[model samples]
Target: MLRHEFHPGKLVAGLSLLTVAVVYAGDAGGAWEAPWFVALPLVMAGLLLAGVAATIHGIRPRGAARPEGGPQGSGKLGD
Candidate 1:
C-alpha cells in the first residue's frame, strides 16, 4: 500500500490516445474533422514527448543511492 508518485509521461501518452479516439468518434458522428496525416504526427509527438519526459524524469537521481525505508506498514514501496 505504497503512496505512488504522479507520472506526467503516462498521463500525456494516455491523453493522446484519448484525444484521437474522441476526434475519430466525433468525425464519424459528423461533429468534427480530422485528417489521418495530421492525427498521425500529433500522436507521434505525444508519444515522443511522453517518452522524453519519462526518460528525463527517470534520469533524476539516476546514479545515486536511494534513501532508507521507514518502518514496516509505513505505506512505502520497499523496505
Candidate 2:
C-alpha cells in the first residue's frame, strides 16, 4: 500500500459531520432535545475550518531534500 499525506481538513470535516450526526441520534434516542437548525452553524463552521486547513496545507512547502537519481533532481532537461 502506498503511503499518502495526512490531510487535516478532512479530519475536521469528518469530526464536524460526526458531531451533527451524534446530536441528531441523541435526539432520536430520547437522550436530549436538538433543534432542527442546530446543524446549520456546525456544518458552516466545519466548511470554513476545512477551507482554512486546506489553504494552509497547500501554502506550506514540502521537504527540501530530493531523492537521488529521481527525475526532479536530475540535471538533464526532460525526464
Best by lDDT: 2
lDDT by residue (tens digit), candidate 1, 28-56: 89997777666797799889989988887
For model 2, how does the per-residue alpha-carbon lDDT over 1-79 read when each residue is reduced to its tens digit?
9977788899889988999999999999999999999999999998899889887877755543344566565656685
- Estimate the Cα RMSD of every predicted model relative to the unseen true structure: 6.0, 5.4
Off by over 4 Å in 2: 62-79
lDDT of 1: 0.79
How much lDDT does each candidate structure score? 0.79, 0.85
- TM-score (C-alpha, index-matched) for candidate 1: 0.64
TM-score of every model?
Answer: 0.64, 0.74
Q: Which stretches of candidate 1 lie over 4 Å from their true place?
A: 62-79
RMSD of 1: 6.0
Error of 1 at 13 (Å): 0.8
Candidate 2 clash pair list: none
List clash counts for every candidate, in order: 0, 0
